[model samples]
Target chain A: MAVLLALVVAVMLVGGGIFTLLAAVGVVRLPDVYTRMHAASKAGTVGSGLMLIAAGLHAFDFAILARAFAGFVFFILTAPVAAHLVAKAAHHAGYRLSRHATCDEMRDHTKK
Target chain B: MAAIVTGLIFAIVWAAVTGSLSPLNLVLGFLLGLFALWIIRRDFAGTRTVVRPWKLLSLLILFVKELALSAWRVAVLVASPKMDLKPGIFAFPLKVDRDIEITLLANMITLTPGTLSVDVSDDRRFLYVHALDCSDPTAVRRDIADGFERKILEALR
Candidate 1:
């Protein structure tokens, strides 16, 4: 059972690392601010969460588990808000969206 | 009542799981759990307000969009010829008043590529942010207010 648990933890860490790496790559390859934000926020948050969970499992202690879980929860709660603020700051600074962008929410906001 | 009970349970569980109920570890974990409860309680203080599910959903979507967009921008800037960057500091007036919300906003700005929150105004009225290549200032402010601020206000209000 311990071996199985170790295997599971290993897989989680590896998978999370790969996802985070992909997120970094997406940040490099994607076009424009909005799209990059999408990749970074989702990948960063979920990847970090999974990695922390794996770390908790590897430790196999309740205190460490609680700390890991708490950290994960904090990440989930904050990542989105941070992303939104960045985008909002960029938008407010008059950065132009790609022509491909279908909706212009900022324009609507200015009229108000 | 439940929070206190859960706090005690967390302390006891952590102590047993670690098998080292040393006075130090127990005291530390207990303090940590108490801190966690304080944060959680403060965040959920106003239960009487109606929740806005759509606002929450939109906030998530906006964050994802911004992350992808910022990363790409940074990559291009890194690859571009002459390494030309018009980096400048801009002050963004914040409408969100809550401490948790403002902290979240500041952290988000700092995490996004090509931008960082440098400082907050003493009065908490504006945020000072540095942009890597600031070609246009108005659009940046609009993005901050309309794109992020609006969603946060909706969800937290």
Candidate 2:
């Protein structure tokens, strides 16, 4: 049982670490701020979630597990909202995406 | 009724797990549970209901999907040059009325990279958020309203 638990924890750590590395890359390489926001919001949340889960499993305590689960829940609840706020801030600051971009929803709303 | 039940269950679980039901620890647990109940009561306005299993399953799936997509995007971004950032703030109209719901929304916004919830309007209708990279303000607003807002509405409502 201990060995099995260890393996699970290892897998989670590796997965989360890889995801974090990918997120860092995306933050640097994405064509625009919005895309980068996408990278950060998604990767960061998952990586953190996985890490927490691993910790919970390793601790082998219900309270720790519950707390970890709660943290994961919190991450899911907030990540997208944070990303949207960042994107909105960038747009208001006059950040422009490539001309290939298609829609502009906030602008239309403001016109009304 | 719920509080008493929860407290009783928690006490039993705590005692069983720790093997020490010292008076001090028992009192502490009760106090913590009371605090949790109080906070929940304040935010939910006395409306209490059992959580639906299906909702929890769906939420878990949604979170996984969002995580994978975001990870891929971040990988690409970090590999690029010119590091051009367009940061600014925009007011977001909120549909959630419950204090817990709103707080959850605010925390969610803050957790996502490159964004932060700055302020809430006096009337509580709009939230001002700052974005690290704002490619399109309107798109951002719509995404928040549709994505997070929609999910939160479903979960909390």
Candidate 3:
């Protein structure tokens, strides 16, 4: 059981670490606030969630697992809301997408 | 109604699994139960969605697969030496009106790669979405309507 738990923890940690790193790279590389927010919110959540699971398994304590799982749930519930607000604020403030962006349906909708 | 009872029962099961009967244990169990029911809700006879649990699980599996695929696409785009992309914002007219439904759809979209839910219109008729690549708006709209919105309706009633 201990071995199995340790293995799970290790795999989750590594997988999560890579994802988190990718998200960081996205923040630095993406063209605009909107795109960057994509990287940060999505990858960040999955990465953190995996790490949280790893923590719970490593601890092997019911209370710890419950708390960690709760945190994971909280992250899922909150991250998207946070991203939505930031993106809304950015759009309303007139932050344009990268030059490669092909359309702006939002502007059209808001105009009419 | 069934879901709540299932959650309560799940809490008891959880307490047994963990060998504890504390209130906290029960609460945690309840949460797990709720989560479980939310996932397999279709299997229960009293479930409003009334789809197979496997179907619901498959939907989620598809969603996660898409999530990873999009994330990878974004990652590759960013890694490319020259970043040439067209990021556009578009109004995605919504089929869902209820607050919870709208919220769920928006969150799922945001969680998936390359899309962000900006805002909903005053009357909740349209959701303003910013797609990472909006060259094909038709495809994006279809994907949302057929995928997230459809699955949400299936799971919740």
Cand. 2: chain B TM-score:
0.65
Top TM-score model: 3
**How good is the docking of model 3, by CAPRI class?**
acceptable
Root mean square deviation (Cα) for candidate 2: 6.6
Residues A19-96 of candidate 3 have per-residue lDDT tens digits of 888889889988789889888888888888889979987888876777677678778789989999988888889887
Residue range A25-90, candidate 2, lDDT tens digits:
776666567656666777767887899889988999876776777678768776766665666567
lDDT of 2 at A73: 71
- At residue B51, candidate 3 shows an lDDT of 41
lDDT of 2 by residue, B1-157 (tens): 7788777666655554454568877777777777777777766566664555576567556645654554554554565565565655567889887677787677656554444565566578877665656667788788788877787777656
Better of 1 and 3 by DockQ: 3
Docking class of 1: incorrect
TM-score of chain A of each: 0.93, 0.89, 0.95
TM-score of each: 0.49, 0.56, 0.78
Worst 10 residues of 1 chain A by lDDT: A100-109
In candidate 1, which residue ranges exceed 4 Å CA deviation? B1-157
TM-score-wise, the better of 1 and 3 is 3
Candidate 1, what DockQ?
0.08
What is model 3's native contact fraction?
0.57
Indicate which candidate wins on lDDT: 3
